[model samples]
Target: MRGVPGRLRPRSLRTRLVLIATVLATAAVLVCQATGLTLMRSWLIGQVDDRLTDFRPPSPVFRDIADGTAPVRRPPPHEALPSDFRVYFYDAEGRLLPDSLGSGRSEPRLARTIGDGLPEDGRPATVPAEDGDGDWRVVADPGPDGMRAVVALPLDSVRDATSRLLWFSLAVGAVTAAGVVLLGGAAVSLGLRPLTRVEHTARSITSGELEQNVADTSPDTEVGRLGLAFNTMLDQLRAALHRKDRTERGLRRFMADAGHELRTPLTSLQGFAELLLHDPHMSRSRRREAHELIAQNADRMSRLVDSLFLLAKLGDAPTTEHGPVDLLSLAADGIAASAVRHPARRVTLAPLTAGGVGDSGELDVVEGRGDPHQLAQVLSNLLDNACTHTPPGARLQVRVGSLRAGPRTGGTERPGRTGANPPLPSGTPVHVVEVADDGPGLSPQDAQQVFDRFYRAPPAAGVSGDSGSGLGLAIASTIAEAHGGRLELDTGPGEGCTFRLLLPAGRP
Candidate 1:
């Protein structure tokens, strides 16, 4: 037979609260018990003292005495005292005196009182004593003619009374303590009710109810503070969510604009090329010109497609590897290549004394493992953008170095220019790469939007034809992000534009 599995039991909050309250209540009861015991003991002792002080022995009679004045009968020994009191008499030297209690039913009480002495008050000194049958309160006193007297009363009656009262008090105290514990637990649970409400509200908020706020009946308490903090967090989250929505909308609009722009060029190029192919009797020069046009348009379309592909890849691809890729060397190589490709344009390389590299001596590689090919694509886009934008004979300068440590560079704007050269803030270290040109720079308005996809700056005066797909800077910016860096533009109406790329030198 299968053994029965034990059922899981849920813990009770009320029970825990009751237990805590009960422990404290029990402690309080114990303290009260101890205090009562002490007070009762003292009162009982005081009662005994009072009884002894108030007690008096019966007066001696002369009828049975041989000499009336001498009380010859000597009060029959213990005969001077009442039936409830056992009496003994002693001489001035403190020696035991005779007593009649020896032949009475109170002989045991008499025996216990034998050795007692009288106090200075001519009254008996009360002493605690026991005779097998029960406890006794014995008192000793002086008698006439240098004699002493002693008396005793059984303590059983007083003891019984005190014991009954003590037991009653203990019973009452136990009941009161239990009641207090129960009441205290209930009070605690009621006081914490607001917290439970807050918990419920928080759970509701987690289910996308951002507008819900914790109910605050008491504003001056901890629960109120918690509610306020929660509301504040919710406010911030709502704002962030709104901003994210806006950004997504803007990206979608930009993608649509890019698609529209690409479609126009593609349709024109296709139609023109097909027209040229259908003419069989075309002259050699005309055919050559048609062929060149087709080639140029096809190349332009290819470049556009390549830019879009690069942007999409940068946006989605994960960076997982990092290693040194010498930006300085890469810059020199790019300039040499561009110079050779476009011999008409002047390209200059301003080499710093030291090359910028990662802190680990790996050429400021994107620290985390990332695709090197993508990183190179980013640099290539930046260099190509500078080459294409600048006019022939313009001097292009590339600088690769580390950012100066300390105090941020701050600037507003230059006259007639939209670009600003802000100083690097203090204590912000970075690897800096600059690509500058001597051609007329972009306007302030254009500079801000230059990195946006499908955005093209208005052509400068005297430039012949529209030559770019407007994705150069956008693609470059995307590449920079993949490398954990930013591409910024500095340009003005008169001043040449400077594109600065800053990458962190340390591990991400």
Candidate 2:
């Protein structure tokens, strides 16, 4: 019951268009038909009135009848006058003249009505028939000797003609309206086909078919433009859904990994505390060792929790104090730290330009805009990751340079940048810091998501039990992005890995 109006209404666009067009066309046709019929009926009635006005009786006979001088034989009214016409006579005193024209067939007895009201003027007028048959177009004519004669023509023929034409016009109008509806519906459907396709695509997408796309993307027509926009929206929505799914999966994995990491430390702390509590006869040295172990595990859990909190903050909106930073200086510091941390590994700063090799003074200063502390941390993390994954004595190089004109800032590669030296506008210099290491490079699959939180690649074959939490690279990536920079990895199996941090250069 609630849906009755919805079901009865023209809900579809095509139906509404056709229905509206047909209604308007039908109205216009009806108006024209009415106008034409009215004019034609008026003209027909005018002709009848003209005939009535021009009517004349036989002059001699009328004069004789007026003078009452001759009683000559005369034809009856029906025989003398046209079949559809009648005649009535009146004396000078406006009284009916009965048996005036040898009244045969008694011409509907209109004498009293015509004689009482009709004037001696030669104009026609319409009056009701005395016999109640129909209307009559009557005109009064003044004869000789103050005599008056009235001529009336029945309007039945005009009425019948107009009636026939009205029905005919209605029939033709109905046919034309039907044609308009059929043809208009077809045209409207054809015109709306692109929109229909877009609707179908949208429906399919709502049903979890994210790959659906509208086909008509031409920019020529309105529907074509709509299709293009619809397709673009679909693409964006699909990408958003993919990002959401990926994010959900990553969150689940992060929870699992964080729990596992925290659980180990918690278990260690619990076990050590229980040992100290239960072992009343234990030696002082053993109790102190247990206390130290508990503290270490507690510290590990605290660090893990801190990393998780930091990641949450970074993921939402990371706030940083910006300043001019020298990538070269940061790279040098990272190299030095790596050397001290992994004493056996050789860590050095590599010169980017041809002029300098093994000399820090000769290299150009790669200045950028970022939080100095965050940038330093990113460099440190990259270096540490390199040393942790590589074997001892592996040579790691930190290369820093500035591109005079290169890809745009924020890691978007400019179009038509196929050449090694692509022509680009020179402004907003970009700083590049590469931390390259001679280690087992990540597989393609691993490199794809290396920056994801809690994601860790398999350690090198010789390395075992690397106890580092995997938030270093993820945090570094987030910080770089927060500073409007990006960290990219260029690596392949057996080719070693190069983690490149690109930052927008700042004014010195």
Candidate 3:
């Protein structure tokens, strides 16, 4: 993090959180300050008003003045004046009496809004000055004559105190807000430590260290949940990467095998062509053999190339353009073809009706939707595999039909098992076409990898001619999978192999 560039680093979630907390703290501080200022002002003014009402002027002053025996004694200036207190008297004509000190200077006319207001007995009212500096709260009482005695408090001291309080509040609020921001930022950073770890883990992953995972913490909290999800995602990524690595390895091996297969035919063709070119005195039979060798090698290379192309096409998810294919017809045709190709072998087609039968009978029909061309290829490959692995006169049969799902007399089967499929959901039906031969069956290990490209087991006795590229079953498997079906192998050593092609039944 110290060496990381600013623009590339992730934005801080902590800063935003701290800012919001500080703003809220500031608002709370402001509210408390305002309330405190308001209450202080009110309480001070109430004290001033009480003082004005309770403090009696010299006892004979009011009566003597009314009797015209003596002049009124003004309230002492030091007791009230400098502290922002003063006195006033207004006659019936609303003229201020001369001795009244309503203003520090002598030009004493009251503002009209304040002059017209009469004080209620217990309440004092504030009057404002036009200069925007000092203001007054006035309390009025009845004098001996048709006159009103009013006491005025300047409100300057209260204003001064509040002004000082405001500044003090601001200082304290500033300190508190700073503290909140600092402490909150620290707390947030600590709280977000898991996210930081997640970030570090991500960086390590990008740097090719995929094993790094966020350390486990509390599951009930937000960051903990995020860490959990992050680790899960990492696990998925690692698994996908592992699969990719395996696929690449498989791809390399496949290419190596394909190259080896092609090289043999190419080498033979080259040698034969070279021999024909170099031999000027070659016999007719020898020359003919050379040409035959060329053609044969060419054929071998062509088949291998064609098989490769077909496997590639299957990988591309070639379109099915499916229609109902007759499994019985397909089996019969494959068996007939195999019979012609290996006349020494006995290949037969049998059909099972409602219940499975041991012997051939009237052919039964079952249908599924798939590309017939591809399906035929699947059947042909199974027949060919059986022929290559079995004895010269081995017994081979192709059977096709439908079977009801659910509640079989015996346990149902999975791939590599010589039994029926697990009973389909109740009332369902499955169409199956199978090729079984009396050749040596496969061991469990071989059966598992039998569908892999270019695999070859030991050839049977008297098996001659070009051994296949081993792509037949692999291509067949791909085709079956693409059709939403499966090509399953049921074979074990000495018992022979049965390839069951199970397909979803076409709608009636």
Who is ahead in TM-score, 1 or 3? 3
Compute each candidate's TM-score over C-alphas.
Answer: 0.52, 0.76, 0.81
Give, for candidate 2, the lowest lDDT window spanning 10 residues: 415-424
> In model 3, how large is the Cα lDDT of residue 360?
50
The stretch of ten residues in a row with the least summed lDDT in candidate 3 is 105-114
Candidate 3, residue 477: the lDDT equals 81
Give one digit per residue, the lDDT tens place, for model 2 in 1-508.
9989988997778888999999999999899999999999999999998887776877676667666687545575556654566666777777766534433333443546443566547878777766766677878887776767778777888889999999988998899899998888889898888788888878987898878788888899888899888888877987898899998987798899988888899999889988978888999899888888888888878978888888788778764577777777888887887778877778878766424335454577777777788788889889889888876656788888765434432233443211112123445466778788778787878777677667788888777655477888888888877776667776778778877776666533
lDDT of each: 0.63, 0.75, 0.74
Q: Pick by TM-score: which candidate is best? A: 3
Cα deviation of 44, candidate 2, in Å: 1.4
Candidate 1, residue 458: lDDT:
74
Query: All predictions: root-mean-square deviation over Cα?
Result: 10.9, 5.5, 5.3
